[model samples]
Target: MDTDADARVAAGVTALSERSTERAGDEFTRAAWLSLADPRSDEELSPFADEDRGWVGEGLRWLVVAAVSYRVAGREARASRRGVEGIAVARDLQTTRSHPAQRACLDEFVADFRVAAGMDDADAAYRTAADAYREAGDAVDDPHRLATSPLFRAAAAPIEQVARGPANGEIAVEWDDLHGSDPSDPGAFLARRATYKRQRFPSLLDRVVDAGRLAAPRGTTEYGNDSFRCPDCDSTDVNWIAGRTLCLRCSAPMARA
Candidate 1:
């Protein structure tokens, strides 16, 4: 039977099929963390234990989509949130159980995240160090140092630096409002709240158009849907104001005659 990339990484079976077993476990573990963080299906999780589960599971992905609906057409915040969430999910998955090959993959993946997150979040560094310790064992006890490999130790160095750096007071919630809410079930209260917010911000130019009571000239569709109707006169005769549609008859200034 043909197994997917995830199955190969999680089980370390595919890595061994292609590469050496020495660090196959770590490599597989890394792959699992990275994949789980981005996105996956229930079928994919079947091979993994509880520890391998995604950060918030697949449900949170939907919530993220809902959140993006509130932001502008293409804001950076939305994209950044998605990227960070992926990293967070992967970090959670890395600590999960894995075969020898899978474990090595995970170590490398964890090491990579540690370096990235260290740029901003200090806690990430400490977490990486702890993971390496668990893998390698105590410094005094490990003589041949077979318990954990050098790569594991190398991954921990940068993490330690992060822990010492100045701390930022920013909070890291997946979705502030979506918390304690279910993304799978449409009826969830958070989902309802999100819906309301989406409706409130329907378009960026709603008010200036005056209750959407106006529209642009028939020939002018330069702004596309951004055009608005004059709210006061209830006419299509409106002008763009602060990126909003405003009625020319109501508050719009006439051109110099």
Candidate 2:
């Protein structure tokens, strides 16, 4: 992880994710947080896995890879196998740009960004996460624009689908809720051209922070391995999670001497 990107992203999230550490609470694995943060969790396409042997930063790396690809390779069809190419880009980015703990911070904020979205003030929460990535600049995406551009859509509930619903004026209401909705009002005409806020329920930040904190730890842990050490890269980190009992340092599943 690039230090420049790390510092900028952290600053943006910390400033926007105003919730104190007391509220954020608990250290979670990347997979654990993804289950709640990623809107497309049902697709199970996210690289994060609850029982996987990696850090939350791993997921941020994927998100970055996707963003990079979206900017450079054009949008990827999530349903297709070609999406796998993004994984390589992600690995290269993670190895080149981030350190372990710094990656943890990335993982935490991305998840927290969604966590904050469930709050009454969704804009503030999203701004924090979005700004962080934007500010990352060459370390990641351009600070002036979204890396995914407009082509990127949240995989689950397509925003396009939501926009297809009846326009504000088309839905006749018993009473005018917005002051500008009334035709006789001076601003009514201009209001007609503006987009109206839609209604959607959200989950609270505190309600979802736990799943990640309790998830298996990522990177090097206290548990060390003594056998099948690598000669080429000197890889030896142990991954003891149920789904992945391998070497984190080199992606070697089973070290054979």
Candidate 3:
């Protein structure tokens, strides 16, 4: 995907995170604090667990979608809540599960999320993570499991749906609010939606990507280096802004090698 297309996906994911966080209230705030707080025993942190599980679980589902979207886009997309606080919230949810496989699935999701953030090609990493989540979701047998919060099933639905085609084939993303007019064409959808986001939530979008740097840091590779050359203009004058590397000469987003 081109840089602008990638930026749109990032904005859409960021919007999803922000909406979920707003609904989750203190659950997100407390989890974010815990993620940054000094190490404490599980018992010490148990007090905050009384917060609303429904909203927290919903927020977590959004995180999963964001991660899946990044993998599907296979580009430099940023998500606001998926940063440090987001992972902390996911870990807290994992601890509440007694099902071994479910916990393990969440572990794989976090690991893949980190791995995808650092890689130029995250298709395989995310695909593996999505598959693991699907398998875990399918393992639930008991009706009681469905009655209680079935995080795996709820969170894995989008991943499974989008990744249903051939293993090496292209993915068709169709999230309701996230996609634009043509849902099947993710690039077109994101690019169009980005224009709307730029005009409507301009400030919010900036804040989201800026804050997301904590989770997905753009590396310190110098611009003039052989590896950092802009693919379009071949210019070494590139700058990082809101997680995108853009060439100063042509104002095009530079793809990293």
Best by TM-score: 3
Going through the candidates in the order shown, the clash numbers are: 27, 7, 0
Sorting all predicted structures by lDDT, with the top scorer first, yields 3, 1, 2
The candidate with the higher lDDT, 1 or 2, is 1
Lowest-lDDT window of 10 residues in candidate 2?
150-159
Task: Please give, for residues 96-157, the per-residue lDDT of candidate 3 as tens digits.
Answer: 66654455445544543343233332344334443443344444454233323434343433
lDDT (C-alpha) at residue 222 in model 1: 22
TM-score of each: 0.23, 0.22, 0.31
User: lDDT for each of the candidates?
Assistant: 0.30, 0.28, 0.38
Instruction: Check candidate 2 and list the clashing pairs.
Output: 1-97, 1-98, 2-97, 27-213, 28-212, 28-213, 30-56
Question: What tens-digit string does per-residue lDDT give for candidate 1 at 1-257?
Answer: 32243443323322222223323333433443444443444454432454322222322222222122112123334434443554554455455644322243243333233223222432443344334433433222322232123322222222221221111101111132221243333223222222322222222122311232211111112222324543433445433332333333333322221
RMSD for all candidates, in order, please. 22.4, 21.6, 16.8
> Residue 100: error of model 2 in Å?
30
- Model 1 lDDT vs. the true structure? 0.30
Backbone clashes counted, model 2 = 7
